[model samples]
Structure formats: C-alpha cells, structure tokens
Target: WVINIVRFYKVYCDVEPKRQALSKANADLAVAQDKLVNIKAKIAHLNENLVKLTAKFETATSDKLKCQQAAEATASTISLANRLVGGLVSENVRWAEAVRDFKQQKSALCGDVLLITAFVSYLGYFTKKYRQDL
Candidate 1:
C-alpha cells in the first residue's frame, strides 16, 4: 500500500509543470541563502569599523584634553611673567628717583664747601697784615 502511494506521489510530482516549479523554488531558496550570508559578512565588517572609529574618537578626546591642560599652564605662566615685569618697572622707577635726589644733594654740598673756603682765605690775609704792623 505504501509503495502504491509512493508511486502515485512520484508520478504527480514528475509532471513537467510541477518539476519546473520545484526547480525554480529551489533556485530561489539558494539565492536567498547566499544573500543572507553576504549580508551577515557586511554586518561583521561594519561592526569592526565601528570599534575602530570608537577607539579613534576616544584617543582624539584624550588628546584634546591634554591640549586644554597645556593651554591653561601657559596662561598661568604668562600671568606670572607679567607680574614680574610690573615689579621690575616699579623698582626701576624707585631707583631713578633716588638718583635724582643724590644729584641734588651733591650740588648743595659743593656750594657750601665753596663758601667756607672763601671765608678761610679772608681770615688768613687779615692776620698776616696785623703781624706786619707789629
């Protein structure tokens, strides 16, 4: 009985239209499977690219942070240098004033010395005349 059923099914499936339809369906399934495999490979490649891009982004972020820190340090150094320059200018101004004061004092001292020398000369001449008279 099973043999008879198998023969009937085989004959029905062996018709030209049925055989062509089955063959076309099998080909379509094979193409679909191949497309699935290619899609999966593309997905894997895209995942690897994502990982690489993530690493590059992280490195770029770290480098940017370092640059910011360097900029801050440079700013502080510039501020300190400016302060030092201001201090030097102040000291130079004080030194200049002191020099002017010293010159003024020296001139006054020279005038006083000239006056004392003239008075001593006059006294010396008057005593010499008195001794001659005696």
Candidate 2:
C-alpha cells in the first residue's frame, strides 16, 4: 500500500507541472487570439473609412468652392487612411510574432503532456509488475 501511495504521489507530481504549463499555454493562446481579433477589427474600420472617403471624392463638383472643400476633405481622409494603414502593418507584424510564439509554446506544452502520459503509463506498468512479483 505504501508503495502504491508513493507511486501515485510521483505520478501526481509529474502531472502537476504539465498542468501548469498547459494552463499558461492556454492563456497565451487566448491573449494572441484577442490581439488578432482587435487588429482585424481595426483593419476593417480603416477599409470602411477609405470607402466613405472615396465616395465623397467621386461626388465632388469642379467649382472652386466645392473643389477646395472636397480637396481638403480628400487630403485629410487620405492622410488619416495612410496612417491607419501604417498602423495596421505594424499591428499585423506584432500579431504574427505573437502567433508564432504562442504556437511554439503550445507545441512544447503538448510534447510535455505526451511525455508525461507515457511516463505515467510506464510507471503504472512497473507498479503492477512489482505487485505481481511480490
């Protein structure tokens, strides 16, 4: 009984670290997913704004007053759109980096879990064999 208890304790100890690692990997994946969603939303908003600006530019008349006003609107929108594009590019880079890191961590944690499972199976086999021998 003492031997079985020791074996169980060892298994529990081995599993505990893997459980913690899995939790951390899950957390990191969630954070990366959230960042990706936010970045996509930002890109969508920028595209919508650009479309609105394009429509305004198309409808403007050539009269000096209308032309100047439209030109100013166009310029401002273009500038804002360009900045948004630049920001999106940077955000995409960040998202990509985060996804890569999260993937690596997830892969490593999966490997650890697999290894622990195999170790536990082997330990169980050994414990049973020992009991039979006794």
Candidate 3:
C-alpha cells in the first residue's frame, strides 16, 4: 500500500507539471489568437482605406484629363482669335488705303468744278454785254 501510494504521488507530480504547462500554452494560444484578430481587423481597415484612396485617385485622374482637354481647347481658341485679329488688321489697312484714294479723287474733282463754274459765268456776262450794244 505504501508503494502504491508512492507511485500515485509520482504520477500526480508529473501530471501537475503537465497540466500547468498545458494551461500556460493555452494562455499563449489565446494571446496569439487575439493578436491575429487585431491584425485581421487592421488589415480590413487598411483595405477600406485603400478602396477610398483608389477612388479618389481615379477621380483626380478624371479631373486632370478634363482640365487638360479644356486647356487644349482654350489654347486653340486663342490661336483662332489671334488669326482673326491679324485678318482684321489687314482688312483695316485696305479700307484706309481706299479711303485715302477716294479723298484724293474728291479734291481733284472739286478743282475741276470750280474752273467750270467761272467759265460759265464769263460766257453769260459776254452775252449780256453784246445784247446791250446791239
């Protein structure tokens, strides 16, 4: 009976250590599981943030494209406007030259009209003087 008691005590001692080790291992596993859960949550949050950032990037890209197109269109419009201004300037020069020519012709015609008027008056005076003498 003493031997049996000794044997049982030895078994109990071994089992006690094993049980304590198992408990500690379980506690460590629990800590590892909690860490894993936290990491997964963080990954999910990061993924959500990534999705939002990606959408923003896409929107920014689209806006950049639109702005680029607008800038190009504006540049072309300015180019056309400049061409039109050049054409208008040329037209203005032509019109000014025409006006100058017309003015010169008008001056020449005015001198001719004055000479003709004086000749007609002289003829009329001679007719009256001759009739008086007759």
Model number with the top TM-score? 3
In candidate 2 the C-alpha lDDT for residue 64 amounts to 58
Candidate scoring better on lDDT of 1 and 3: 3
Clashes of each: 0, 0, 0
Q: lDDT score of model 1?
A: 0.91
- Local distance difference test, per candidate? 0.91, 0.90, 0.93
- Per-residue CA lDDT of candidate 1, range 13-104, in tens? 78867789989999999999999999999999999999999999999999999999999999999999999999999899999999999988
lDDT tens per residue, model 3, 1-134: 99999999999998999999999999999999999999999999999999999999999999999999999999999999999999999899999999999898897997888898887776666777684664
Better model by lDDT: candidate 1 vs candidate 2: 1
Candidates sorted on lDDT, descending: 3, 1, 2
Worst 10 residues of 3 by lDDT: 125-134
- Name the candidate, 2 or 3, with the larger lDDT value: 3
Task: Provide the global lDDT of candidate 2 against the true structure.
Answer: 0.90
Evaluated against the true structure, the overall lDDT of model 3 is 0.93
The parts of candidate 1 lying over 4 Å away from their true place are 1-22, 98-134
lDDT of 2 by residue, 51-131 (tens): 998778766644557889999999999999999999899899999999999988996898899998987776775767684
